[model samples]
Target: MTAQHAAAGQLQLNYWAEARLQRWGHIAVPLSSTRVAIHGGYGRDGKKLRRLDDVVIVSSDGTVAPTVSSTPRPKARERHGAAAVEGGFVIHGGRAGGAFGDAWRWHDDVWRELRCEGSPPAPRWSHAFVALPGDACLVCGGRGDAGDLDDDAYVLDPATQTWSRVAAPAFPVAFACSTSDGQTIAFGGGRAARFADAAWSELALDDATAAASRRLAACVCATARPGELVVAGGVPADEGEVGGVAVLRIGEDVKCVAEAPLDVMRAYPVHAAAAFSGDGVVVFGGGVPCLSFAPVFGDSVRVVMT
Candidate 1:
């Protein structure tokens, strides 16, 4: 839990703690200013992948403890999308052997699966599921049964518990990472992470380092300040390197937090989870140390802010 003091305007990725399991693709939800809850992820078992089933709580001091539910829990999963709102935490779509379309909410200390009205989105994984303006959420493009889906975004209106498809081109693209202050959202990434509302336009990012900041499945969180975001580990477009933490402001150039990106940061945390709590953003477990038959897993817990 130790940290080096950073310059006033620069944000640094400080090592927070070594998590219990070296897992990746987990969901991290900020329970409060001082607490974060970690859910399922994938861990390596020899040459195979094992789905983790542990629920742990992490304190600001870097202590870890396992937690369990009195009621039934959702089937162990990874690469799932979750949104932490005022009332509860909503999670959807992930794979455990196959893709899942189930929607579950965490409330009253239990994992309760939601029975939605109308049909749900196709069971898919590696997609974007984000919390929007209201309590409703948005789900878009992921790898579906037939293969990579086209740009069809689905909105889950909690009021009706039904899903309606949104035909915004900005979506699915924006869906990759949506940063909001609960009033508006900023979307699109790579090369030049654009701030778009409903329209889609490609921005050529020529900087290799900047372009790779937060690619597919990178963790994102809106900072305490409006229009500022912290981006962390993911597979970069160039796929040059595997680790780094950078800051992206709507109208400013991307800024790398530290002189050495991986000096204090975790590597290749493609589907790592992030939550904005207190004055910084906490990043949990991520992996893909190497894209080989026997891949390495991660057990990293770090935080950064700008």
Candidate 2:
């Protein structure tokens, strides 16, 4: 891992952590106090796995520590999808040896089970989900059994403990980076079908009603911001990753404004995570070459848009 300073007086970019198998699966989350939280398993010497049950907190003022502990951790299960919401973070829909469709929330120093009814999403892994500004969450397609892709779309209302079916414009794709800009939900590149094709989709919410209009083609990653959905680095095929950052803004049609204009091209399986910080955006750890089952990059890069 290495450290480099970016731009003027922005945050110091630290990329000093080596990649391990268990560490690669961790996800980066930004805290309310301008710090970052990383949760996962880390490999110490390729021989032992360090459980990342604790949330690592890093601040710009040069403070770092673990906020929570895994000693008395929640139920042991692989986390595939996560989103930071009103109270805390909600983890959903991961697979172990079999598919998992359960939802758990991490808030107030404890993990609580969240139940819903009315046709829940099928047990799936690598499915994409995002919490909207309101009490709504949208989950999309992912890989199912026998290497088949799922095309189901479900909306969970935490306030009502109910689930409802939503229209799926993009079908048969897993590992897509699905996120929202408060109003519209966008999904971008992943293993589309069995052949490893690349594509994108989106759902726009009306100003008055919170109903999603339809799915559109404006792929983005977890690193996207509100109103601005950007695809930093993703795989064009199953073989390798691309360095180009495909960018799109939410408007009348949700069109692509730029492509690969950034300084870096992301590697494959780059499960990038980001959050809004202050006036700009804060992007956390991501993987390379392919979707890493463990955490790879351990840097906190702060992005301030012009």
Which one is best on lDDT?
Answer: 1
State candidate 1's TM-score: 0.80
Tens-place lDDT per residue, model 1, 121-185, is 88887777777766777777677667876457677876567887764444344234455544323
* Alpha-carbon runs more than 4 Å astray in model 1: 1-9, 44-49, 170-180, 183-210, 251-260, 264-267, 289-295, 299-301
- Error (Å) of candidate 1 at residue 251 is 5.6
Query: Which 10 residues in a row give candidate 1 its minimum summed lDDT?
Result: 251-260
Candidate 1 accuracy as lDDT: 0.63
Provide the TM-score for each candidate, comma-separated. 0.80, 0.67
Error of 1 at 91 (Å): 0.4
Please estimate how well model 2 matches the true structure, expressed as its whole-model Cα lDDT: 0.48
Write model 2 residue lDDT over 1-306, tens digit each, in one string. 344444322223323332422233445445564655555523243455443445555564435565654234444333356666664777676555666677766765566678778878877655667665575777776655555445567778776778887766464443333344444344434212111112234444232111111122112333335555444433344334333344445554444544332234222224445455454344454444225463344343444444
